[model samples]
Target: MTNTAPSLVLPEISSARLTGLLEFLQSAEQLKDTLRSGTTANGRPESTAEHSWRLALMVVLFEPELKDIDLLKLLKLALVHDLGEAISGDVPAPLQTPGDNRQERERRDFLTLCEPLPADIAEELLSLWDEYAAAVTAEARIAKAFDKLETMLQHVLMPRQEASFYAFNLGYGVDRTDCSPLTRQIRDKVDGLTRALMEDAGRESA
Candidate 1:
């Protein structure tokens, strides 16, 4: 009783948690190096961080087009949308379909990474991630849609390479119109734009 509950030792707890978060976030950044077999405009492999960062800009572009959307929330969601990839790696759309892989798996991995975070922050971010995957709200839907658009945009920007065309032409399409109106509008524009890009790439290669 001489030292007032032995100083409570909370600092160590907090410091350890912080150290873990920093470690995980740094690891998250390296995920950008785990390429998706998708090339950039210059035909270079894309890192996970680069993919997420570019998608953020695409989300920014949709702010004006969204119907009663939360721009700031969407931006944050886009920023962390793929943070789980640090653990799961970049599991692109073709392989990550409805059943084989889902949000639950990603959420589990994200939760593990944030275990050091104050429970509230960890839970909240996880919830935001779930919301992003669900595409239930306007902000989340648009953020999620921008995620898809970014993949296509990468195809548009990619150099004349087989991977570039594969990204643009192979196994990519949108089914639901209601999930995102702005995204639907953008998709229409992307179809022709990506096609032309592919043609240009083909010409250059030829």
Candidate 2:
């Protein structure tokens, strides 16, 4: 019978599990529609998904400098850091208040989103999200720092908004971004860009 290559076999996955996975992914598509406060160079409101994608790319580009950190974990943290925004949407940074319950709300939404996923997969993702929310691990901390930097970079590069918009970024997440010397240096560079943009906006309004 020529041994038939030892009869290849593959593990079976229940159809229900497969369906749940696909449903979860379909729900995640909402992220593509959740608009953030930042605009593109062309002045279109940027989506949360777009911001997350760029955040991941930023981490990959700086992987060489992010010594002793797990690159894969950093990327996952970046991607899912805002995944909950898909449901409740992003509250504009300027409107956010101290003790606003934003983090709690987002975590609830994240847990709901993972409900359709396999238990093991859901737990793993929840752990990552929780770590990022807490900024507990080195990977989580770096991801948080880059998250702030990426938002600052976007604000500065996008078409000029009101001077207040640029100013808002100057003081946005200093504590988070100040986690490391390199992150502080990057924040300073973005702050410089933000100042130039603020000036340009001021000139226009003058």
Candidate 3:
């Protein structure tokens, strides 16, 4: 028999990993998506990674318009908004998916992962996450509005597409009649982006 040392079983997410955890942010951060499918816009459906990237871009582009609000903080707030998805994954919209209870489940999972994290960072992320979900504060409201608007943008970006991004029609994919004025403004800004995609992509382009 050969003499050998047994492998040590490690606990969840060691300190080294915790220090480097931000790298995990780039992985597939979206849910309510498919493995090999295009978006309602003909562009590939956004993974959670793309979603955050787009949101960051939006915040930068729109910050000048938001003269009254503290946009830098809002951008930081929006940036980490979906990291919880690393644990729970994303669900497209609340209505279409059933019984996942994603927010609660993901929160629990993240809380566990927070153990190895520095206290302040973990608390800040959790607070930002809750703020996004609440949509109560001005920054949170603005962030949430863009979040919804971006999802809708995918719908109108494709004309010939059958439109199955979600179960509901939402009646005029670009409509934001019920959303707040800030959200509507964000829609106005991104509206041209979708149009540009349609014009450029024609039928298909990644």
> Where does candidate 1 stray beyond 4 Å?
1-21, 161-171, 176-178, 198-206
Report the Cα RMSD per candidate: 7.8, 3.8, 10.8
Q: Whole-model Cα lDDT per candidate?
A: 0.71, 0.92, 0.60
lDDT string, candidate 3, 63-126, tens digits: 7777677787688767777766666666655343566677788677656655555667678778
- What are the per-residue Cα lDDT tens digits for candidate 2 across 178-202? 9999999999999998998899899
- Error of model 3, residue 86, in angstroms: 1.3
Error of 2 at 54 (Å): 0.4
The best candidate by lDDT is 2
lDDT of 3 at 204: 59
For all predicted structures, in order, the TM-scores are 0.76, 0.91, 0.64
Cα error, residue 92 of model 1, in Å, equals 3.2
Best by TM-score: 2
Q: What 10-residue stretch in candidate 1 is worst by lDDT?
A: 162-171
